[model samples]
Target: MNFVKRAGMSLRARKSRTAALLGIFVVICALLLGGFLLRSAAEGREAAAQRAIGVDVTVRKKGMSAADAGRLGALDVVHRYNPRFPVRAGADGFAALTSRRPAPGGARAGGGGPLAVVGVRDAGLLLPFSYGSTGITSGRGITPADAGRHVAMVEERLAAENGLKVGDTLRVRSTAGTRTVPVEIVGIFADPTRDPTGAAPPHELPGNVLYVPVRTARQLGSPGTTGEAVYRVGSPDQAERLHAAADTLLGAGSFDFRVNDKAYRDQVRPIQRVGAFASLIVLVIAVAGALVLGLLVMSQIRERRDELGVLLSLGERKWKLVGQHAVEVAALALPAVAVAAVAGQLAGPAAGAALPGGGSQHRRAAAADGVDATVPPPDPRVEPADVARVAGVGLGISLVATVVPGIGILRLHPRSILADTE
Candidate 1:
């Protein structure tokens, strides 16, 4: 109690020094709280995107001709063993049905609905064409064996809205003609983006969509939908060169076609920019934090020179003086860190919500959609594990900041402090 009282009196006597130290703590706490939340949120968002799409590149046949493939194959950066294939709108010849359906006014009349069809010859090459959420979730993705016949994978959102499920049957109709076939629901999906929405009963299709073998797309979506090629380039910088080469091979006549590296470019650009910024911010904060702490400790030592001298003259060991100061600083810093950690937890969600690219909303919506929804993905949320990690990180940062200043104080000599006594 006596020791505590003396320490309190000493702190009161050196109000200016104590206040300066507290100010440093405040700045450190604020900066760390903000920075950690930003870093964690950005990391989480990136991880989610990456998990959703593992493919480095997605190639679509928006603008490819037969000749384009020759040039694409010739690109220097094109990886060997790279796969490519054809994708096209559905055609009657390719729209063979594998399921049975009822006639009008039959029991399962509601089960029969329009299908969004695409024809791909080689499922292996089109690995990027996988499933993600729309407004609803989905069961297993499409497999290579699921090809052929009129087997269908309907989006879960469309399925729920229409009360359709796997093993059900649908009547796929071609808009250009009266061609219709029965397709088995091998899989049900929940893709609102690709399906329907709003006052239209959600399952209504504005027009018919069909998927047949790629050779038949010319008769379906666009008459001009001819052969398109994709070449995987080693780097984004190679996109221009690859584009030029593809144009040369396809001939100037088909130059009206658009070559889009936008998806690939957009994907990589943000990652590079974010990585650079994160590194810069962390580096600057760490260095500045250390320097501020060092200077603050040195300044405090200077201000307490007389106190240090009296301690030494009264037989207090130099190391003991150092230890006492260290203990007091630690006591103050631990509380500051604990408070800051709580502040970080409270701020994390808000920061995550405000994070760019609609991160927070996506997570929140996914959560609200819940497992009860047909299409289900694990909810993106800050778990207790995340909070614990953030707490550890905050305390770690505070520890470093506290230790950095002590480096200067540790360099002081007993003789230098004692000289003030004489």
Candidate 2:
């Protein structure tokens, strides 16, 4: 019989040994496939979280002149920049609309309570809008055309409470009560944390917030009043580089650059940990599987020594004997590898989901970004490249395990083996 036929016969005769080797190959392949899939998913999730949190730097300093804002906006790393002019103002008209009477001495009902009047060229580019913490729900957001106009975008809850709508006028009194700016309500926005039980402070409620053009804010406050400028970078990974660039351009002591990457870091932590653990598991399983399978093959080879000796006595080449053993192991492992690929595809995502710390941190990060929806499941298919990789490694392990012991076939003396067996 040819070496191929002999290999088939050997496998048929050693059913238990063949089954054991097949099972080991399946486990190794399954681990490899699952690990690769999990790592891919983790990386994708980390990147998405980073993008959701955004990469922005806030320059908080007094006297951020228009010239300085212009220079910062021109930086190559800056995707966009919005210089805010925040001031405190009383909107008694809105207060009265909410059915709250004035205080004892005729002060506004909310204790002459000041609402946050934020001035910007474009409300869409501001942190709240950019981070998705708030979004325009009615009319239109502040535009460049409204830069010097008395236009405003009030919060939805505030507008509802005051019965304000688009085209209505909001009378705002400056902090010193010296100037009253009447801004046209052009839009309304919804706050992510609009619930009464939300974590925002009483004074910082979305209902007490208003947006106006930068010029209007200047008109209501000191012309020289300076507010913070926020710069949006290209990505989270580039935040530090952009920070250094900003410091170099604007001078280190002149401005304090605060980069808010905490959300991104927190979200990515669990994914990174899971990825590392999966990698380590893959490595351990591959190495250990090889060692265990090799030893088992060595023992099987020893048990078949008398048979190999007879083959050698029949003039079969030693290398052919080794090739026959290799072919048998390959045949046994190929089917197991295929089954493992399917198993990994079906189970990899579930395995990753079950890993500790994967979901909770991601949810918290999403909430920080004002996202309250369920995250969709990751793709579960095993890619062709991953299958190819597992196959290559599995084959390598099988060859090393089988060939190392198959070498003993060359040392087999037909007379010694036949006499020993007898």
Candidate 3:
């Protein structure tokens, strides 16, 4: 029989040893596959987290204008921006919510208690809207396209108080009463905050606020200016470009640009740790797996000394004897790798679950980014390339295991083997 055939027959005849070897290889491949899947998932989650909560650079100055915001927003380093100009305005057709506690110093509020008009290029870019603390209950938010339009997004409670809905128009007068701004309602949002205690003014009440286009606020006595310009950038490093650009545009010492990466840091750090741990697992498993297989192969070779002597004495080439053992080990590796690939789908989730923290913080951070997520993040999954990687590693381990033991026994002659058998 050919050496390959003899190896197959030998494996078939020794069913228990073959099963044991198959089990060992299966375990090794499974562990390696799990590590690869985990690492890939961690990297993917980290990228998503970064996108969700990227760095924000806030620009504030003594007197900033929308024109300044436009120039800075056009920079390549800036992703999105909102220039806020919150000003007080008197409204018709609705009552602004006021605290029952008397107005501070008892100076009566004018025009049914004036409401705050927050002028912005985009309403959704506001911090309250970005965080889940406030959400649009109906219609859509004011976008950049609504910059010069007279559109407004009111609080849901204020909308309910006036029975107002989208498409309804409200008449607003400037605090100075010099300009009258007509705005059509576009959205209604839900806010959890209520009027505070201790004689707060009506305009200071949480519900007595509406979002309008910057042009509307400008028309209603606002300066079309902002203390801070909210900017979204991909990374903290990208903020440096924004800083230099702002310094050139607004002039150094005229404005301050501060980068806030708290959300990105909070969410991405844990995933990075998990990714590092996964790499460690792959390295340790690969090294320890080779060592274990080498020892096992050596023990099996020692037990088969008599068989080896007979094969050598019967005119079998010494290299064939070594090749037979190599073939047996190699055959076990293929099936073991195939089994691990199939089993990886079932095992991947458990491995991901074993990760510390388990995505609760990630979910909360995503929620704060305006996503009302109901389900948890996806679990780790084995990819096709991961199977290929584990297969290659398993084969390499088999080669090391077989070649080392075969070389050791091949150095001894058949006469020495028979002498040992006696």
Decoy 1 TM-score against native: 0.49
* Model 2 residue 353 CA deviation in Å: 2.3
Q: Cα lDDT of all candidates, in order?
A: 0.47, 0.73, 0.81
As a whole number from 0 to 100, the lDDT of residue 313 in candidate 2 is 82
Best by lDDT: 3
lDDT of 3 by residue, 1-422 (tens): 69999999999999999999999999999999988988887877666555656677778986787788889999987778888988888876567776788865788866533788888887766878776678898999999899768999998877888889999998888888777778999999888897686787778777778899888888887575688778888677788888888888889878877777776666567778999999999999988988999898899989898998888888899888888888898899889988998899998887767653345765666666553333335477777788889989988988888888788766868888898876
Ten contiguous residues minimizing lDDT sum, candidate 2: 96-105
> Sorted by TM-score, highest first, which candidate order results?
3, 2, 1
Which prediction has the highest TM-score against the true structure? Answer: 3
> Residues 1-422, candidate 2, lDDT per residue (tens digit)?
78889889888988987888788778778888887787777766555544444456788777777667768777776666678877777765667223233334543334334577788876766877867777888899987778768999988878887788999998988767877889999999988764444233324665777888888887776446455887766466577776676677767777777776555455556667887887887788778877887788778778777777788788888888888888888887778879988898789778657643356666665666643224444555678888887888888877887788877876777779888885
After superposition, candidate 2 runs with Cα above 4 Å error:
1-5, 54-56, 61-152, 156-162, 166-209, 212-227, 231-237, 355-377, 407-419
Which has the higher lDDT value, candidate number 2 or candidate number 3? Answer: 3
Task: Point out the higher-scoring one by lDDT: 1 or 3.
Answer: 3
lDDT by residue for model 1 (126-245), tens: 323322233213344333344445555555544554576777776655435445556666654333343232223212342232223333332233333333333445455555565565
User: Residue 156 error for model 3, in Å?
Assistant: 5.0
Ranked candidates (lDDT, high to low): 3, 2, 1
By TM-score, is 2 or 3 better?
A: 3
Q: Worst lDDT window (10 residues) for model 3? A: 369-378
